[model samples]
Target: MDFEKIQNEIGGFSRYQVVVITTVAWLAFSAGFGTQSAVFISAIPKYRCAVPPIDDPDVYPSLGESDIKNYTIPYDTATAEYDSCNRYDYNLSSCQGDGDLSCVTFDEDPGTIPCDQGYHYDQTYYKETTRTQWDLVCER
Candidate 1:
């Protein structure tokens, strides 16, 4: 009922008010960071199609990481990067005994296909992330 009396009793903009406001502001700032921290933890790392190792050495020799990318992965000219979701559908028999992967022939138009095996995440930056753990990079 007595607005002026209450205002004087509370003390307008006193040191106590400053301390309370500052504490609440600091807590709000910290809470904001806490809520947004998932962006860093759940970040998507560099990844690619996981090309399974050749089980039968006679069919296709076990290739190194780079060799696998060169032989199986398709280079996207538009993005100027290796395609992450798809790989070139090739004939395993054709690649047999071919030390030169470049020389290996492919289907008339060996179009890119979705990865059948899985995905390979580059763990250099993030050891494990949601995108890598849940395989959320590409469509199911």
Candidate 2:
């Protein structure tokens, strides 16, 4: 009935037993990683609202990427980063006539909307995670 006593009567713990136990244990450990690997491979990376590209260069002067992001994305004080789900409801009509790119403006007081456009993701760590592949990070 005692497992240890029976094992000892048979041959105790031999090198063959050690090798077999270790091999089975190693296989189980490696299989665990294989099953759970999706957690890391499909992880959601840092992301933000996608910036709308300039439709007409003549109508609206070209703005740098940083400038566009600064104008469109709202700062989230809670997260201390630009908001991922919402962006400033900007009006590009002001930029229609004037050559100044700064003419574009949006309401800061009561003007935040869910990202109607697609999202931009930080792929520095992962080139394409689940968040980027299926657009899972954006709020509907």
Candidate 3:
């Protein structure tokens, strides 16, 4: 029941002890905030492509035995049409031609390409290789 003795004992704390207690509290607060922020960010869903697959022989037949090919009409995602005459390795293939063109073979890098008629290459991240598709689409 002695108030003065209890007050004196509680007030007697060394500087090092106070500093250690403050640092522990700060670290705990920072860890909690960081974990909550990461959880919130991971819960959000991302946007993705909704186009259907293209599997027609006439629309996208194999390249014939011709030596020289003509102007290649790359794949058009908007119209779901793919040209059959273009040759692409990993390097220089157009997305409008095939979906398997990666950077391991052909010298054409996977990036955007701007044409004369306002046509451009739309780059998207596929499994191992990046994909390109024509961005031009008809309005409904």
Candidate 4:
């Protein structure tokens, strides 16, 4: 009536059987690890609009990327996050002409659209990967 007793009477695992079981277990573990890691490959890293850089050394040294991110990118105060895929369509020459020389966030409007150039993503954890290499953020 006991399956273990019946199997023992029939014969225990042969060396070949043990090898097959070990190989299958290893393969199963590897397959599960690979399946779980698939999402991280396309994982979208935190990103923001990559606006044109200021060539002026005077301005470039004075400003941080965050400053440009604040000025050129739209932020949602309600969510406290910058619009990942959209940027404010502002004329750089005009913005520079204003000479305010300080970051100013504008309200998100119809002008908000997907980044015209591309995006900037954090490369801390990941190197140039599928997501970062392809600029796959926001709508894209």
Candidate 5:
């Protein structure tokens, strides 16, 4: 119960030593927790869509030239030449050529055509299986 006796028994450490020990302890704690935090943050987005903001034009580029002209000519009975072509497909060639083409279909899966011209689709396919697993974990 004597405070002075307890203090004497504990002995004294140098101020520099105390400071170094405290700093080392803090660094070790941060290293452990910091790594864990980083991993968890990275894993969260991988398990979900979490779509990022579209700011740059280069982020979602244009489609092929021949594909655009053939598909977007405005015909009553339109036929898709490419196997990947569909009604909702966006003509990426025009966008790249003039940078003024604003036509895009929300429903269609983006398609890519191979040509010398700058025409390509920005397709993003996300599997639902991984998301389902995350959902199960969240439920638990």
Candidate 6:
């Protein structure tokens, strides 16, 4: 057979091939976009421990939002950010005041566990996320 003749006859990629490839690529991209959009729309934002009630007389009496944030939430020293789930072992009932907070050396404390109280969503980026509808923020 003549290699040069076959090469000339075959030429480059055909118009039909280009169109089919383009169509397939567009469909794949669209499917991926749709899947990702659904996931994002259903995604729950990061959450921390909720602010303690001011009127509660028993638990952390006279405690405010600042005091709760300063004491309850566990800190990530490497990232300089607070952990989304884990909180200090000091339960709200046990915490007498701000001074009772265990903020430093979280690793040293073996009693660290998941947040017992409700979660506070970080709404800085999103106004609302699936977390509002579904309570899927804590534990695996």
Model 5: which residue pairs collide?
62-92, 63-92, 63-93, 63-119
User: By lDDT, who's the top model here?
Assistant: 1
* Residue range 63-115, candidate 4, lDDT tens digits: 56676666777889999987877887765444352235433335534377677
Candidate 6 positional error at 83, Å: 0.8
> On a 0 to 1 TM-score scale, where does candidate 5 land against the true structure?
0.25
List, residue by residue over 4-75, the lDDT tens digit for candidate 5: 787667775568768999999999998999777743443322221111111123543453434444443222
**What TM-score, over all chains together, does every model reach?**
0.56, 0.54, 0.26, 0.56, 0.25, 0.47
The count of backbone overlaps in candidate 4 is 0
Q: Cα deviation in Å at residue 20, candidate 6?
A: 17
Q: What lDDT score goes with residue 66 in model 5?
A: 44
* TM-score winner, 2 or 4: 4
Each prediction's number of clashing residue pairs = 0, 0, 9, 0, 4, 0
Give the lDDT of residue 65 in candidate 6. Answer: 49
Candidate 3 accuracy as TM-score: 0.26
Model 1, 3-117: lDDT tens digits are 8788788886689978999999999999999898896568888878865443234535656567667778899899889888998776543443535454345546687788887
lDDT of 2 by residue, 1-140 (tens): 99999998999889999999999999999999999888656878877776444333454465554665677778878887887788776654454433455544543363888877677777779898765888877552
Off by over 4 Å in 1: 1-41, 54-62, 91-104
Instruction: List runs of model 6 lying over 4 Å from the truth.
Output: 1-44, 54-67, 94-110, 124-127, 138-140
- Point out where model 3 deviates above 4 Å: 1-4, 40-46, 49-140
**Per-residue lDDT value at 110 in model 2:** 38
RMSD of each: 7.7, 8.2, 14.4, 8.1, 14.2, 10.5
Q: What lDDT would each prediction earn against the true structure?
A: 0.72, 0.69, 0.36, 0.68, 0.40, 0.63
Deviation of model 2 at 66, angstroms: 3.6
Model 5: per-residue Cα lDDT at residue 31: 94
Q: What is the lDDT of residue 93 in candidate 6?
A: 55
